[model samples]
Target: MSASAPICLERGDIQGGILRAYGKRGYPRARFLLFHVARAEAGRWFLEQLRPRVTPALDWAEGGESVKPGQMTRPEVTLNLAFTFRGLEALGVPLRTLKGFPEAFADGMAQRDAVLGDDVGPNRIRFWDPVWHGEPGRAGVHVLVMLNALIAAPDVMTARLAKVTAEVVGLAGETAGGVMLLEGHRGADPRWQELAALWGPQPDGRMGPLASEHFGFNDAIGDPVFDGQYPDGAERDKCRGQGAVDGCGNWRPLATGEFILGWPDESQEVAGAPMPLDFSRNGTFFAYRKLHQDLASWDVWIESRALMLKEVWGLASLAEARATLKAKMAGRWEDGVPLVKAPTFADWQAARARMAEMTRAEQTAFLTEFGYASDREGRMCPKTAHIRRANTRDALDPLWDAKDGKGRLGSALNNRRRILRRGLPYGGRDDPDGEHGIVLLAYCADLFRQFEFVQQQWMNHGLDFDAGNDGCPIVGAHREGARFVIASSDPAKPPFVAGGLKPFVTTRGGDYFFQPSMTALRMIGQGLVDPT
Candidate 1:
């Protein structure tokens, strides 16, 4: 499909979380429930009861008009459902249809330790939470229930969740061969996983605004924008830095199939989805990852590294060195200022101050609307930086001006590998050693091509970026003798090498799920999924 081609989606049929990140849309509190379908009939019955409550991608205002950003009235509670491969099998999906899914998804996440680098250190499957460990003599994680809410008080949130949860429990009891809710490792409610925004407490005893993660960096910026994600003019405005960009620095929304199923992708072809058009169309794959952040280790590493880096970077204070080191590692400052835009400590400070006065659009443009064509030498931002590796953003683009032999700024290569990031940080920031990290939900059409490829190739290995085996500085599984190199813009200065890196982010557990469309949900609930 041409870049200028208009793409309209069936918003009512698509699930809400695929197109919109609810945490950003006034739903700060969330609860995730995992279930094992002991019997197919009971599972379908449970799904039937939950079908009416499932939220859609379509956004509406008070009077049912299309909503602009930050203008829609938030729902008291928003619900969505996804199912594992085993979940579908338990629900009596045909063998032919089940076999149509990708191999990586069929094998499950725990079984893909080699590809994901989860076999070693703290990320090993044995160390994972018991919820991930399958029920005795049963296929693990048949169904995933996600509930995002807009409650401010913890008590109110719990009360609301309990009421809805009780209804679900009641439905399960109404039929024989009932489903069972899995016990999560964290939270008071063992039956379900409770997740909330990492908001700090206010001086007046109320919760403050959305806060940073345990790593102390602004999170959830630069999420991918695909065709039909936003309405008309809003699409252009929001796609500025969130979408595909060409050599001319012109931005456009990526093809819908890159994130959603059954649409023409960047390749101009609809991928071969699961059997039956109604089942796969408008549906997407989901990767639910629980990452635990080690604050104590991070603090110790930063405190010790900054002292040495202070002299190497020629910075006045250890604090400045620490912040600069972090920015180089992440390719962005703590306040979400890209290092490509603000390379130095002084520049970062100035940028932060300027961001305070600039409009939201201006701030977003400054932070995200940047390319790596000018910084091929990794001078401004290291080629091995976390953001650089995650989104190459024109760095991998070949020379567009063949006559002039000039490397072009484009996101064509990156577009196919893009995955929509959903979910938010889980635990409190105050207790570093506590169960605090991000509940990362990565949604895409192709799990292997998008989610796994990014995890294995970009984040876990740096060969593509020309940094050899060096992984992402922030989240990579830093094996023995792992080090991060920060290149200097000055010809006279040598690159700063920070060593003794360990795994800062460890995978607690995760799984692959299929988030089907509203139409598919109905078919599954009614047990009318006819593969023929």
Candidate 2:
């Protein structure tokens, strides 16, 4: 394809979740139901009945027509389905077809404990929820049915979800050979796990606007931008901070194959994809992780580290010290301002207010447009910061050739590792050590290359960023004496090393599942798969 050529996607056949994050749109509440398929026939029947209801990537208008992206009102309730390796076998998928899938999907999240840093500490597999741990009596989780709703009221959302559950259960018999809804959630309804975006309070005590996660950081700031994610004209703007960048300072959406199967990837070829393109083309893989936040520990650690930072940096107030420490660790402020753009505590405070006044597009540009080329020494955003490691941008490029005058070539390398981050926060705020966390759902074509590599190399280990074995302070496994070093631009002031880090986030449970396209779903439901 030429540089000026347009990129198109099979919107109608693709799942809506892959193209859009429902939580970021209008769907603020969700319910995830996991099930075990006992009889292949019944499972196929359930899928056949549910296929028509599955939301597609098309931007559907109120009158049932497909409009251009960003022009239509979203659906009131959106539902998507995915299958585990076990689920596919239980559904009678062909052995040859199953063998074609990537090793990471077959091994699943539970099996790759060591690689993901879940081998020990609170994130160990033993500490996972029963639904994921595979309790002796309970059946293995086979199917994941996700329900996202525009409804925001807690009670109303619960009632609607309960009614939907009852309907689905009725369709699939509740007896032997029928689909079984798995349990082990933290709420009253163990059959389904509830999710809601954290919203702030209004003056009248009503929910005001979208708020940050339990850790007080703005969530879902920078998901990947791929070809056909939005309309052609609209995609260019969205790709400013979220897409692949070139050495010449040009930004463009990544190759479609990086996220969806059967398309030209960043390598400009669609080679080595799973066999039988019909079954794999529009489908994608998903990693479902239930991350529990330790609020009490986070609060204590921040307060303890703030005093040390205050003394080291010679800051005026403990508040500035705490904010600076968080920005250094996260690569962004609590309000989603990037340190590269606003390199000081005062700058972040001013940026927050300025961002509030700008249009949505303008705010996105300000937050994500900056890079680490100028601050290669980790002066503004530390090398160990979560965002820096997660998306290196241009830091991994070769030494800049000033004579040639082109930028670093790191975004080309980072493009292949991009994943579409979806899902919302689960549990409530009543308890500090309670069942409150985010259900992180990431979608990609190759789970191993995109999702697993990022988790193992970037988040769990800092070798890629040249920070030794130091892990991400916010989400990584905190071994003994976990610490984060913040560098200063001034030669007079030495680096501020914030130590004594504890486990702030732990894995409750999760799995690797394949979300097939609408075409593939039909074939699976009809038992028409012929691997040859």
Number of clashes in every candidate structure? Answer: 0, 0
Among all windows of ten consecutive residues in candidate 2, which has the lowest summed lDDT?
399-408
Candidate 1 lDDT over residue span 1-532, tens digit each: 3357567788889988778888877777888888889889889989998999888887757556767753444467888999998889999988888888889888888888888889878888877778887757644788998888765677787678777777776776676547887675564556777788776675488775464677988887888877888765357667877788776677788888888889989898999878888989999998899998888789999888889888876788998989988888889899899998889898888888898899877988887898887787899999999888888877887764434434454656688888888887877656544777888999888888888889999998999988888889899988999999988876777888899998999998789999999999999999888778
Clashing pairs in 2: none
- Residues 183-259, candidate 2: write the lDDT tens digits: 88766567778888877786489874475888888888888787777866467678888888775567887778888
Alpha-carbon lDDT, every model: 0.83, 0.82
Predicted structure with the largest TM-score when compared to the true one: 2
Candidate 1 displacement at residue 435 in angstroms: 0.5
* Stretches of candidate 1 exceeding 4 Å from the true structure: 1-3, 62-74, 135-139, 201-207, 400-411, 431-433
lDDT accuracy of residue 167 in candidate 1: 78
